[model samples]
Target: MNRVEEPLLSVSERRIATRLCVDAPLGAGQTVGLAPQQAHYLRTVLRLSTGADLALFNGRDGEWRARIDALGKGWASLAVIDQRRAQQPEPDVWLVFAPIKRARLDFLVEKACELGAARLLPVFTQNTDVSRVNCERLRANCREAAEQCERLSVPEVAEPTGLRDLLADWPADRHLLVAAESGHAPPVAEALARAREQAGGRAGVPASAAPWAVLVGPEGGFTEAELDALSKLPFVTAAGLGPRVLRADTAGIALLACWQAWLGDGDARPPFRG
Candidate 1:
C-alpha cells in the first residue's frame, strides 16, 4: 500500500492479472465481449491470442482496456482499450439472505459481491433449507465476482422473494438490517446509531439512505412467526454480530462485514469501485 499505491495495479502473469486488472480508460482500440466461461478462460486457460488484453465491466460502464477482437470457431472478442477508473458510487446496500446449501450458496454470492452489496435479496425463509436457487449460477458468480473484484457494479441478484412477501411490501425507506438470532439484539455499533437516528437528516432520499438490508436468518432461525413479523417493522433493526451463532453462510458474511464496518463504503471504498 505504499510506492504511491503501486499505481493502482496490474500484475498479469499472462492473464494472472491484478487490481481487477484494467481499470476503465483503455488504450489499444476498443472492443470487449466475453462469457462462455470467459471465452474459455481466454482461449483455453489463458493462452490468449488474436491481440489479447481483456478486462471490462458494463455495470454502468467504468473499467476497460480490451483487445482480442474475434477468435472464431466458438467466440472470443474484445476491443475497447481505454477508460480505467471512473465509475464510483455504490452503497445502496442490500443483502437479504436465507438460501443455504451448495457451497454456502456460492459463498453467499461471493461475499455479497465482495462486501459491497448493492443488492442480492434471496430470501425465502421460515427456517429455509434451500427452496430453489442457482439464479443462473448465482448470476455467473456475480459475473465472476464483478470481473475479479474490481467491480464497476453487478450485484442486483434478486427474485427469490417471499419472507412473507419481503415483509409485506417493506420499503418504508429501506434500512432493514435484521441479523437477529434474538439473543437480545442491538450491538452493531448500536444498530448503526439507530439507523442514523432513523435517518432524520435526509441525505439521499428513500429515507436518508445508509444501512440498507443484510437480514440473514435460516439454519433454523427466524420463525417466531418470522420473529414476530420482523418485530413489527418500523423499518426493522434488531442487529447483533457477536456471541457466536452465525451459520447462514456465516450470517451472510457476518452481516456484510458488519454492514461494511458500520454503514459500508468499506473503509473509504475500493473493492467494486462502483
Candidate 2:
C-alpha cells in the first residue's frame, strides 16, 4: 500500500507565516490569538501540536516568530518569539473589475492578491452579470492569499460601486487604465509609459501617487455607451490584451499581470525612478 505524506503544515500555515514574517515584530514570549477557523485548521486539519512554530503579521506590525501555544475546538493561540522581517509595501496599483459568478469572483480575489494589487474595486456596468458582492468572503480570500503570497498587507476590497459613479467623481490626477476588447487600443506597456508621463514630476507625487486603477469589464464587456463614456474621459487609456476574447476573470488577471510587468513594482522599478 502506498502511503500519502502529510504536508508539514496546512494551507493556513501561510497565514501564520505572514503574521510572523510580513507584519509583526516578534520577540521571545510574545503571543498571538487565532480566530475560530484558524484554530480549527491547526487542530483538525494540520493536526499540529502545541509547541509547533507558526508565523504572524498585522500589516502595521513587522513579522514575528511565533510558536503554537494551544489548540482547541475552534481556536488556537501562538506565542511570539522574536521579530523576523520588517514590513514593506507593494505597488500603488488597484484592480477595478466587474463581479462575475461566485467561483470566478473568488478566483479573481485570490489572483488579485497574488498579483500585488493594493486594492480591489468591483464596478457594476450595464453589461455586468453579477450585481451583489459578499464582501466578507472576498476579504477572507484576500487574507488567505496574502498569507500564502508573503504580502505585508491584504488588499482592500472596496464595496461595489456603479461604473458611472466611479468615473464622475474619479480623482483628476489619478491615472485610469481600461482594458478594451478592441485590438486598436495601445499595448499595456505603452499605456503605463503614457500614464507616468501624464502624472509628471517626482516632487508632487504622493507616495500613493501611482494612484492607478485598471478596469476589466464583464464577460460580455462594456456596452457601447459605457465604452464611449469611459473613452471620453481624458484620464482613461484603453489598452488591448491581444486577440482572444477573455472571460471577465481571465481578462482581469491577465491585464493585472501585464500591467505589473510594465508599470508595477514587480518590474525593475521601471518607468518611475525612486
Highest TM-score: which candidate?
Answer: 2
Question: Which segments of model 2 are wrong by more than 4 Å?
Answer: 1-29, 196-209, 267-274
Scanning candidate 2 in windows of ten residues, the lowest lDDT window is: 1-10
lDDT of 1 by residue, 169-236 (tens): 87787768788766588787787755555565233332225547878887888888778888888878
Tell me the lDDT of candidate 1: 0.69
Q: Return the TM-score for candidate 1, rounded to 2 decimals.
A: 0.38
Error of 1 at 125 (Å): 5.4
Q: What is the C-alpha lDDT of each candidate?
A: 0.69, 0.74
Question: Candidate 2, residues 39-144: lDDT per residue as tens digits?
Answer: 7777887788787766677776656657787877887778776655566656777899988999999999999998888889898999887779999999989998
Off by over 4 Å in 1: 1-55, 58-68, 100-126, 129-136, 141-151, 156-175, 178-200, 205-210, 214-222, 225-274
